[model samples]
Target: MKIIAYLDAGRIALGVVTSPTHFIAVADVAPDLPTDLIEILEREDGMDRLREATAGRTGDRLLADVTLKPFLHRPNAMWALALNFKSHIAETGLQTNPDFPHLFLRTEASYVGAGEPIFAPPYSVARAFDYEGELGVIIGKPGRDIPVERALEHVAGYTCLNEGSVREYQMHNRQFGLGKNFEASGSYGPWLMTPDEFGDPARHSVLTRINGVVRQRAPLDDMLIDVAHTVSYLSRGYRLRPGDLIAMGTPGALKPQPDDLEGQDLSRQFGPFPTPGLVHMRAGDVVEIEIDGLGVLRNSVITDPAFEGDL
Candidate 1:
C-alpha cells in the first residue's frame, strides 16, 4: 500500500494515498505512522488492514495536501553508499575502489520532511551544499548474516531520498559525518511503498532534477552492490533494526563550481569530462527527486543562520 505523511489541520497526520480524492486515516486504524509503521511492516496480515483503513476516505486529505516528513523521524542510523554508481565515478574522474562497499553515515539530526525548506547553514561553514538523489531501502525485519538470495525478504519497502552534502566540510573534516549530517539537510519522503507495490526494486528508474532540468538518471540495476548483500554485509558485525535506512547511492551530474574566466585552475574545469561538481542550491531553487512507482519528493532550498550544538 502507498502510505504518506501529510498535514491534517495544523498537526502532521499520516495517511494512505488511495487517489486524488481519498486518503485513509492512519490514526483511525493505527496510532501513528513512524512508531506504528513497524508493526504493519512485520505483520503478515497487516497489509489487508492497511488497505481497509484507507480504502474509502475522500477529498483534499487524499492527495498530498500537506507537507511530508521524514518517514522515520528518528531512524536508528543512516547508512549511505559513495561511488557505488560507476557513472558517478566516471563523471568525477575517480577510479573505482575495489574490495568493499563505500559506506558513510548520516545521523538522525539531518532528517527533514518533503516540502520543508533545507537550511543552508552559515556561508563560511558550508559554501557548497550538493544533492545526491538515491533510492533508500527500509529494512522490515531483524536479521544477521543474511544471504543475498534472501535479502529482498527482509526489505519492508522503498522510498526516494536526497542525500544533500556540504563539500567543504566533508573533505576538510577528519570525519565526513559532521558536514553530511547537518540539520534539515537530508530531506526524503512522500511515502513508503511496500515491496509488493514497489515490484522489482532494480527495475525502477531513479531521476533527479533541479528547477526543471534532469541532472541525473539511472536504474537501480546500475548499483554495484544490490540491496541484499548491502544489508547482510553491513549487518555482519552490527544489528540492523527495523528503522535503519540504507541509501543505495547516486549517479553522475553537473554541479556548481568556482569560476575564473575559464583560465583559473586547470584542475577545476568542467569540460564534458566527468568530475563531481558541487550542485549547490540557492535560496529559491526547487529540487525534485522521483522514483517511478515509489513517488516524488520535492523541497525548496532556504538559507538560515548556523545552528549550534547537535540538531
Candidate 2:
C-alpha cells in the first residue's frame, strides 16, 4: 500500500496512491478507518487493515489537486546515519567504527513536505549549501533491543529523503550541528510505500538530479551499514516507535562537468568536500530524488524572505 498524508479543504486526510499522480482518500473507501498514519501503524495488523480497506480500488482523485505534507504533522523521533555509505566515506576520506553505525538526530522542524520549497541558507551565512539524497525508513512496530533478524519486522514503509546540508556550518564543529538542523532545508515524501509492496531495498537505486542533471546515483546495497542492522542498532538505545524515521546515509556526489571550483570555498577544518568542483544547490534550483518503487520526492530551492537581497 502506498499512503499519502495531505490537506484537503483545510482538513488533513489520508489517501492511498494508485499511481504517481493520483490517489483515493481512505475515508472515501472506509469512513471508519483511522485518519492518522501512525495510528494505523500502532495496530499490529496495520498493513492488513490498509489492504482490506482499499481492496480492488484505484485512486479517483488527482494528487496534483491537493497539498501534500509529510505524513506526520509533528515528526516522531528522527534519526540519521553519517558516513554510512561506502562511496560517501570513500570520497570524503572519513573513517568510522566498522562495528557501529554513525548516528545523529534531526529535529522535526527541519523538514518541509514533498513539492514544498526548500530554503537555502543566505549568502551572508555561507554558500556551501549542498544536498544529500538518501532513503528513509519509517518504523511501524515499536520495540527495544530488537534483534538483527527481527529488525525488518518493525519497518512500516519507505520514503525518499533529501538531506540538505549547509556545508560551512556542518563542518564548523566536530558535529553535524546547526548545519543539519537548518529549518526548511530538507524534505521527505511523495508517499510511503509499504514493505510488502516495496520488496527488496537492496535492488533499488537512489537517483538524484539537480535541474535535470544527474548528480548522485548509487545502489541501495552501497551502504556500509544496511537497514535491518541500523534499526537493530538504534533499538539498543532508544525504543523505536511507530512513525519514527531513519534516513540511510547518502552516497557520494558525482563530480560535475569541468570539475572547477566555482569560487566558493569547499574547504573545511578537516578537508574539502568529496567532489570539490561539485555544484551545490541554490535558490531557483529544482532538486529531485527518485527511487524506482518509491515515487519521486522533488522540491524547488528558494531563499527565505528575510534573507533576500532586498535586506
Candidate 3:
C-alpha cells in the first residue's frame, strides 16, 4: 500500500494514495487509527490495518488539492551513507575505505516535504549547493545486531530523498553536520510505498535532474555497500527503531569537475576557487529526484530571505 502524509484543511494527517492524483485520508476510513504516519507504522499490524481501512474505497480528494508533507516529520534518526557508490568516490577523488561505510546524521529540521522549496543560503549562488538523489529505507520493526540476511524483514517501506549539500560548509571540517543540516536544505517525500509494492530495492534505478536536464542516473545495484549490509552495520551499535530513516548513498557526480586535481592541494581550492561543472543552485531552479517505483520528489530552489549576503 502507498501511504502519504499531507495537510488536510491545515492539519497534518495520513492517507493512502490510491492513484497518481488521488488519496484517501486514513482518518476518514478508520477514525481510530493514528493520524501520524510514524505512529501508525509503529503499530504491530499497521500495514494490515491500513489495507483493511482503505479496502474497496476510492480516494476522497485529489492529490493536487492538498499540501503534501514529509512522509515522516519526526523520524527518530536520519542516517545518511557517504561514498557508497564507487563512481561518486572517483568524482570526489576520495579513496575507498574497504573497512566500513561512512555515515552521517541529519536533523529533522533539515528536511522539507516534496513540492516545498529547498533553501539556498546567502552565498549559495557563490558556493556549492549540490544535489544527491537517493532511495530512503524506512524501518518498521525495531532490532539490534540484526543479521544481514534478515535485514529486509525489518524494513517497512521505501521513499525518495534529495540529500542536498552546501559544499563549502561541508569542507570546513571532516564532519558534515553544518553543511547537511542547513534548515530546509534537503527533502524527504511525497509518500511511502510498502515493501510488497516496491519489490527488490536493488532492482530499481535513481535519476536526478535540474530543471529539465538529467544530472545523475544510476542503478540501485551500483552501490559498493548494499541496503542489507548498511542496515546490519548500523544496527550493530544502535537499536534500529520504528520511524528511523536510512538514505542509501547516491551515485557518481551529477555534474563533475573538468580537471582531475588530486591530493590536499585540491581540497584547499574549494572555497576560493571555482569548481568546474559544479553548478550551485540559484533562486528559481527546480530539482527533481525520481526512483523507479517510488514517485518523483520535486522541489524548487529558493534563496533564504533571512540570509543577508555573505559573511
Candidate 4:
C-alpha cells in the first residue's frame, strides 16, 4: 500500500496512492482517522484499519493537481546512517567504527516534500550541495533495545530519501551537524510503500540523478550495515516510537554521464571534490531519486535568497 499527504484546496489531506498519478483521500475511506501520517502510524491498528477500508479502492484525485507535503513533517525523531555503505566509505575515504553504526539527527526543516524545491546554500555559503539517496525506514511500533531479529517487525513502511549535504559545513567538524541539517536541503516521499508492498530492501537499488544525469547508483545489498541492524543499534539508546525515520545510507557515485566533465575538468566545473566525479547540485537543476519498485522522489534545486548580503 502507498500513502501520501497532500494539499487539497489549501487543506491537508491524507491519501493512499493508487497509481503514479492518483490517490484516494483517507478522509474518504475513514473520516474519523487523523490526517497526519505519523499520528495514524502511532495507533496499533492504524495501518490495518486503513488497509481494510481502502481495500479494492482506486484513487479519485489527480496527484499532479495537489501540492505534496512531507508525509511526516515532524516525525518524533529522524535518524540517518553515515558510511553504512562500504562503497560510499571507499569513495570519500571516510571510516566508521567497526562495532557501531555512524548516526546523526536531522531536523524537520531540513527536508521538503516531493515536487518541492530543495534549497542549496548560496554560493558564498557553500557549494558542495551533494545528494545521498537512501531507503527511508518508517517505524511502526515503539520499542527500546529492539533485538536485531525482531527489528523488521517494528517497521511500518519505506520511502525514498535524498539526504542532501553541504559538504563545506560537513567537513568543518566531525559532528555532521550543520552541513547535514541545512534548511530544506533534503527530501523524501513521493509516497510511502508498506513493508509487504516494498518487499526486500536488498533486492532493490537506489539510483540518484542530477537533472537528467545519473550520479549515484548501486544495489542495496552492498550496504555494510543493513536495515535490521541499523534499527536495532539505534534502539539501544532511545525508544524508537512510531513515525521515527531512518535513512539507510547511500551508495557511491557512479561513472559520470558522457555529457559531464571528467578528471580535472569535472573538478574545475564543480570546484574541488573530495572524490573525483562528484557533482554538486546547482540551482535550477532537478534532482530525482528512485528506489526500484518503490517509486521516485523528485525535486528541483534552488539557491536560497534568504540571509543574502544585498546579493
Candidate 5:
C-alpha cells in the first residue's frame, strides 16, 4: 500500500492512498494517533500494525477533494552519498576518490514538504545553488553494524530526495555537510512507500524534471554503491536510528560538465556561473523529482517565509 503524510484543510494527517481517487484515513481506523511518522516507523512491527489498523477500511474515502503534505516530519538526520554513481565521476572529469562511502549531513531543519515552497535564503550567500535529485532510503529499524546480507531488512522504504546544494558554502567549508544543510532547502516525499511496494531498490528508474522538462535519466544499477551496500556500510560506525534518511546520491547527466560551457563565454573560471552545474533554483521555478514506483513530489520555489506552515 502507498502511504502518505498529508495536510488536509489545516490539520496534518497520515493516509493510505489506494488509488488516484480512493484512500482510507488512518485516524478512522486508529483514531487519535499520538506519534508522528518517524515514531510509527521505529516501533516493532510497525508496518504490520499500520496494515492491520487500516485493513478493514479501504476505499471508503475520496482522494481528489483532499490535499497532501507529502513530507517526513522530524527525521533524525539526512545523510549524504558522494561518488555513488560511477558515471557521475567520469562526467565531472575527476578520478574516483578511493573513499568507499563518502558521507555528509543535512540537518533536519532543512526539510520541506512536497507541494510546499522552497525558500531562497535572503542573504544571497550562495550564487550557485544547484539541485541533485536522489532516491531517499528511509531506515525503519535501529541497528549497529548491520550485515550487508541483511541490510535491506532495516529499510522501511524509499522516497524522492531533492538534494539542494550551495557550491560556495560547500567548497569553502572543505566539508560537504555545512554547505548542503541550509534551512528549508531540501525537499522530500509525497509518500513513503513500504518495501513491499517499492521492491528491488537496487534496480529502478529515476528521472528529474525542471519546469516540466526532463533533464536527467538513469537506472539504479548505475549506482557505484547501491542501497543495501550503503545501509550496511553506514550502520558500521553510526548507530542508524529510525527515521534517519540515507540519500543514494545523484547519477549521471545531472553532474556538471564542461560541454555546457561550449556556447557561452564565461566571465570567471571558478565559482557558480561558468561551472555548468545542476539547475539553480529561483522564485517561481517548479522542480519535480520522480522515482519509477514511488509518487512524484511537485514543489515550487518562493522566497517568502510566510509560505511555510506547519507540516
Candidate 6:
C-alpha cells in the first residue's frame, strides 16, 4: 500500500494513494485519527487500521488537486550514508573505508517536499551545488541494538531522496554538516510504499536526471553496505524510533578516466571534484530522481532570492 501526506482544506492530512493520481483521505473514513503521518505509523496496528479505514472506499480526491508534503515532516533522526556505493567511491577515486559505514546527519529544515523548489544557495552558485539521488528508508518500529537478521522487520516503507550538496563547504572541513544542511537544498517524498509492496529494496535501481538528461544510474545492490547492515550499524548505540529516516547512499557515474592524468599529480585531481557530466544547478533547471517501483521525485532549481551577495 502507498500512503501520501498532503494538504487538504488548509490542514495536513493523510491519504491512501489508490492510484497514481487518486487517493482517499484517511480522515474521511477515520475522522478521529491524527493527521500526522508519523503519528499514524507509530501505532501498533497502523497498517491494519489504515487498511480497515479506507476499505471499500472509492478514492474521492484527485492527487493533482492537493499540495503534497514530505511523507514524514520531522523524523526523530535523519541519517545518510556517504560512499556506500562502490561505483561512487571509484568515481571519486577515494580509498574505501572498510571498517564502518560513513554516516552524516541532516536537519529537517534542509528538505522540502517533492514538487517544491530546491533553492541553490547563493554560495553554491559558482560550482558547489550537486545532487545525489538515493533511496530513503522509513523506520516503522523503535529498537535498540537491532540484530542485522531482524532489521527488515523494523522497516515501515521507502521513498526517494535527493541528497543535495554544496561541494565547497563540504571540502572546507572534515565534517559535512554545513555543506549538507543548507536550507531547502534537498527533498523527499511524493509518497511512501509499504514494505510488502516494495519487496527487496536492493533489487531495485536508482536513476538521477537533470534537465531531463541522465547523470547517475545504478542498481541498489551496488551499495557497499546494504540496508540491513545500515539499520543494524545505526542501532548499536542509538535507539531508532518510528519515523526515523535513513538515506541510502547514491550511485555515481563511472565515466572513463583520462589516460593523460594517470601519473601526473594525482592529489590535485582526486578529491571532491565536480562529478563528470553534472554541473552546478542553475535557475530553472528541473532535477528528477526515479527509483524502480518507488516512483519519481521531481523538483525544480531556483536561485535563493533572500541572499544579498552578488551571484
- Top candidate, metric lDDT: 4
Instruction: Name the regions of candidate 1 deviating beyond 4 angstroms.
Output: 9-12, 30-35, 39-48, 55-60, 254-278, 305-311
Task: Write model 6 residue lDDT over 190-261, tens digit each, in one string.
Answer: 788899999999899999887777778899999999889889998997999889999999888634335423
Instruction: Report per-prediction Cα RMSD to one decimal.
Output: 4.7, 2.7, 4.1, 1.7, 4.3, 4.1
True-structure lDDT of candidate 5: 0.73
Query: Residue 224 in model 4: shift from native, Å?
Result: 1.1
What clash pairs does model 3 have? none
How well is each residue in 1-311 modelled by candidate 4, as lDDT tens digits? 99988898787788998877788889987999988888888888899999988889888889988888888857788899899888888876777986787888999999999999998888778877889999999999999999999999999999999999988788888798898999999999988899999998999999998877787889999988888998899889999988999998988888655656642255444333556556778789999999999999999988886845522
Candidate 2 Cα errors over 4 Å, as ranges: 257-271, 274-277, 309-311
lDDT of 5 by residue, 80-171 (tens): 88767776676566555554667778887777877777765543455555567789888888899999889999988888888877667877
- Top candidate when judged by TM-score against the true structure: 4
Question: Backbone collision count in every prediction?
Answer: 5, 0, 0, 0, 2, 0
Return the lDDT, model 2, position 183: 87
TM-score between model 1 and native: 0.84
Give me the runs in candidate 4 sitting further than 4 Å from their true place: 257-259, 262-264, 269-273, 307-311
lDDT at position 21, candidate 2: 74
Q: Could you give candidate 3's per-residue lDDT for residues 109-143 as a string of tens digits?
A: 88999999998887533366778899999998989
- lDDT for position 197 in model 5: 83
**TM-score preference between candidates 2 and 4, better one:** 4
Looking at model 5, the pairs that clash are 6-69, 7-69
User: lDDT of all predictions, in order shown?
Assistant: 0.72, 0.85, 0.83, 0.86, 0.73, 0.83
Indicate the TM-score of model 2: 0.93
lDDT of 2 by residue, 175-203 (tens): 98998889888999988999988987999
